[model samples]
Target: MELYRSHVLVCAGAGCISSDCQAVKKSLLDSINRLKLDKEVKVVETGCMGPCDQGPVMVVYPEGVFYRRLKPADAVEIAEEHLLKGRVVKHLIYQTPETGSAALTFEQIDFFNKQTRIALRNTGIINPESVEEYIARNGYQALGRVLSKMTPEEVIDLVKKSGLRGRGGAGFPTGLKWEFSARAQGKPKYVVCNADEGDPGAFMDRSILEGDPHSVLEAMAICGYATGAGQGYVYVRAEYPLAVQRLNLAIRKAREYGLLGENIFGTGFGFDVEIRVGAGAFVCGEETALLASIEGRRGEPRPKPPFPAQGGLWGKPTVINNVETWANIPPIILNGADWFAGIGTEKSKGTKVFALAGKVNNTGLVEVPMGTTLREIIFDIGGGIPNGKKFKAAQTGGPSGGCIPAKHLDVPVDYESLTELGAIMGSGGLIIMDEDTCMVDLARFFVEFVQDESCGKCSPCRIGTRRMLEILDRITKGRGRDGDIELLEELGRGIKAGALCGLGQTAPNPVLSTIRHFREEYEAHIYQHRCPAGVCKALTVYVIDEEKCTGCGRCAVVCPAGAVSGVKKQPHHIDPEKCLKCGTCMEKCKFQAIHTL
Candidate 1:
């Protein structure tokens, strides 16, 4: 192997790619080559480095210097000054506004320090496209060990002892699910990996597939072995082209190495995995729906009682685990079940990967132990809410989840605790809400999402979500009546209880949780015709506080509507009739002059 003095890892995850990290990578490589340091230095493209908000993110290993929000020119500077001159780029160093200090190592950064990377262990650390790199990091080791040493029943028993549960939102015991398929008495058993991550702010599954596809492939092979399965399918979202490209590559490599095709490790246990890309339907996240989509049927949820384990994927006993859940299998097998079980809460074992987005200072991906408190995740890890804002609530589990209010900030983030607070651990989309977030609007937003995503196979989720959304719409639009709140509660409960699949069952979660937690906000919107967070346009009117206005034309210049009128260096006034309630004036005003009431 050729030894290099420096290995610069550039984030090639979708988030950083969106921020144009590709250009930054090219610029850095070009500059390095021009400086005749191509042999001395190497640039490697890796997946997400956690702190997504700071993208495009790059790190220089050996020194472990983290560079955030880099421009193409900045990469050139690092290649020249930092790489050649052997001096750190102090200006490009990552510094938290809360700490007011720069971090030398990405590991030492608060966003990563508080996280325990299990499923994401190899994500940012290695070149994901290479099977060799994955093998170097102990990938496929568990599959080999299981095939050579453990029996199918023994493997299932080990997983049961590990207390590992499905990480794809629903907290189903993984080993039990495996056993159900193993003993279902079918001709052909199948293992289906759910990579069709459709949550709005969620990219957890996609990152795993992109950065460490082999791990998932290895885990699926293990599942195939344990469950007595010969064939498997990975149901991935078609929107994730990068993940698809990487997964396809990984699958090819695994098959070439004889890990995927047949008789893996020469154990006569034949297994193969194929990628099945979904057409970006949210309801397909349900197991049966995902199976249906994989079988070339409509992406709609099927009623349970014959759950996927008994009759799934062409009427065969199938074990379906999400990307995160499958990724955890190898570690549990290698480390022993007890080791895996000890990391998390008694019931919900192992760590959870959350797409930590919205309103938080450090918006990125986080993997914390099951019992990690919201306080640790939000403040200690996330560096608290940005711009000195107070956290009002957090929405977990995407549109299918509910709100966690300030009172539950100290609560443990396990499945049971979040469920008690009226939230499910639905695929780990944790959206933070600051004081400025309108809870009523938040509820409406999620309700609307669920309403749109509903497959309409069931009446409760289809019509009930629509009714609840209409009520919320009326409340936000200042046409709310006295009985609107009660009607919402009734409709939300009805939907939850009567809906067909988990999609419909959890459709009303956001509305119910927001009402349970921030009922006062709802009451204000309904009874008093006011939005406490000043978000509802119909209930909100932007006014210029004459006492604080300095007659700066900044607001007037920024406002699309000619609402603000002021002379230079004098008090300004806003015409309420002309104000669009867009809050653009307030955002532009240097002085604290704009008030919403």
Candidate 2:
């Protein structure tokens, strides 16, 4: 082992990679080598650091100097000045968005300070590809202890006592599910990690798999021990190429290290794990559908009763947990169940990781205790809404979730609370909306996504969602009727009650929640024929106020349809028929003369 004076941990997460963290890494290496600092300073490419928006990010250790939104050009200064000369690069440090004050350490950054990392404990902290790094962090200690000291029943009982529910939505008791599979009579049982995370703007599972794959692997092996299973399969989406690569590498390393494969830990206990890549089906997030995809069949859901615990993955009892859920396992085993149970609310224990996107100032991945209120997440942690906009609503659980208005800002976020508000605590996708966002349009967008992704297995989900989407589409297009709201409510309820699987069951949440919270907006679309937020272009008529118009012809030059006409110094006029309602003219108007009716 080489001892280094300084270690530069660069984020190689998918988001950071897309932002050219690879280039940033190369530049750092070149600069470090050029400065003759290669022996003294080491650059480690790690997984996603939580502040994904402000990436490519790096954290220099010993000093813990945090840097964000770095470019290749920035590496020279960091390598030469910070690494070699022992100088803190003040300009490269991470700063709070609201205060614009730089925080030199990870603990100082408010985004991280507010979060309690459970599932994402090792992500961004360790090199996921290296089993040694994983072991250094007490990675497989839980599995080793379980194999050496405890029986399958004890492990299940401890987990059950811990109150760790499934983080993949629906809040199923993790231990109880294991107990069911363990008790069920079967020849060959299986452990499954549902990595087919398809929620829009959600990358929690991908980050974990990319950053701390071994944690998941360790957890799965532990599950295999507890469930009397010798084999495990990770149902990950094919779209996540980086996650796939890292998982494959991790599995190979684990098997080579004897952490996986037969007769593990020299205890005569046999367990192994394999990766099953899904074809990017959103419905496959459903456990049954995921199993079907893994079995090389169409990714369609089957009726549950036999649930996965009773019969899963080829008529055998199975325990399926999502990537996030599995990541929590090793820690629960190592730290003891009580430690894990003490973190969150009574019903929903431990932290929940959310992909915080949309209009929030700090758009990144956040992990907070389950009962943390939305107000804290939105304002204190997320730096409130961006651009001085008021918080209008937030959408949790992606397309299958409902919208939460500002009125419920203080609501404690847990499985039960979210479900009570007409939203499921789905694979934690929290999208914040600002005052300017049109709720109706937002509902329509989610509905469109759900409709397109529906597997079309059952008529209710296949056809009902389409009809609801049509009604929503028509409303957004300025062709809504008075009874449209009632029609939507009827259809939404029907689909929720009749859909074959969870996909169709929760598909109407967005529409239902928007109506429940922002009925006025829906009413405006139908009765007043207007979109109050002016988001629906069809309902908006842009007209220039002659008094305020400067007639610079900026709008005319920019308009693709050539709808605007005016003299050099006179006010401009818009041809209604030719206007595409694209809002290009309004955006270019410098005089603030454009008004939408």
Candidate 3:
């Protein structure tokens, strides 16, 4: 085996890849070869390192020096100065928000250090393409242990004791689901991994698949063994090309090593997996809809009671869990159920992986214990809202989620606590909002998303969500009625009570939750015909403060609507009718002269 003195791990996750981390990697390789440092310095492309905003990022092992926001040119500097000369590149180092100084190691940065990482243990640490690295890190050890020592019933009991609820929106007891599938009378049962992660800002599942494909494969095999199944399928969306590629590779590697296919570990248990790519339908995140898609049907939800555990995938008993939930299984099997259960709250066990986006400083993948508070996630782990802005709200669970206002920042982010706030832990997409955000407009945006994505399977979700969207549209456009707020509440309740599937049922969450918390904002929009945050173009008017206006003509030049009127070195004036309300003037005005009314 070739041993290197220093290991350089570059983030090749989808985010970093889009940022052209490949160019940075090429530069590093060229520099290393030119300097005769290839033998001593090793460069490996891994998956997400959590801090996505800082990509293309790399971490140097031995010293564990973390580098962020790298360019192709910067790679040469890191290779020569940090890799060859044994000197730390201070400028390339990650800057700690608390001290505003360089944090030398990965642990020194609070973004990574504050969270627990069971589901994401192998991510960003090893080369995902190489199954050898995954094996070296005890990747398939859980499957071996379960197959050799434990019975199917014993495995189910262990998971039950672990207190692991499904992380895929519904938080259903995973063990209970397994037990149901096991007990159900069916021939040739199936195990399915729901990789159809359609939440707007979520990449938790995609990252796991790209980073640690084997963990998911191992977990599925374990599920197959427990459920008396011969075949398993991964329902991944077509959008994740990299994740799909890695999954296929991992499946081939597992079969080659006899970890998959017939007679695994010589115990006569047979299991194999296939990839079923989805067409990016958001509703397919629901289990039945996902199963429908896997069977090459139009993805739509069906009424339950004859749930997936009883009849799924060509009318056979099946067990299904999403990517994050499946990733947790192997760890529980290896570490023991009590070990997993002990980490989280009484009802919500283990850590949750959240894709933290929007106004927060640290926007990335954050995995914390289930009971961690929203304040800790936003302020401490997320490094708070950007540019010293006050946190106004957080939108969790994508379009089906509710907005958590500033007052509820201290609420624990467990399943029940979030449900009480009218939010479901729907696949962990947490988008932070700053003080300048308009609550009414935010609600409208989410409602619009859900409305567009509705499969039109049922009238309540199809017609009711459409009604809610129309009302929200009117409210945001300064054309709201007197009883519009009350009507919205009524419609939202009707939809929740009458919608067919989970997606349809939760469709009105954003509107309802925003109304529950920020009723005053809705009143301002409806009664006053004004957006408090000045987000609604029809309700907002741009003006210039003559005292602060330097009149550099920057706003005038950049304005698409040509609303700004001013000469050089003179105070500018804005015609509200001509203004597009794109906020270009405010963004370009260096003197801080623009204000919205």
What is the clash count of model 3?
0
My TM-score estimates for the predictions, one after another, are 0.97, 0.97, 0.97
Instruction: Write the residue-wise lDDT of candidate 2 on 244-325 in tens digits.
Output: 9999999999999999998898999888888888888899999999998889899899998879998998999999999899
**Candidate 3 C-alpha lDDT tens digits along 98-163:** 568788898888898899999999999999999899999998899999999999999999999999
Q: Could you tell me which 10 consecutive residues in candidate 2 have the lowest summed lDDT?
A: 93-102
TM-score of 3: 0.97
Give, for candidate 3, the lowest lDDT window spanning 10 residues: 95-104
Tens-place lDDT digits, model 1, residues 479-587: 9899888888888888878888988988888988988988899899888889988989999988888789878789989889888888998888889888888989888
Q: Which lDDT value does model 3 have at 206?
A: 99
User: Against the true structure, what is every candidate's RMSD?
Assistant: 1.6, 1.5, 1.5
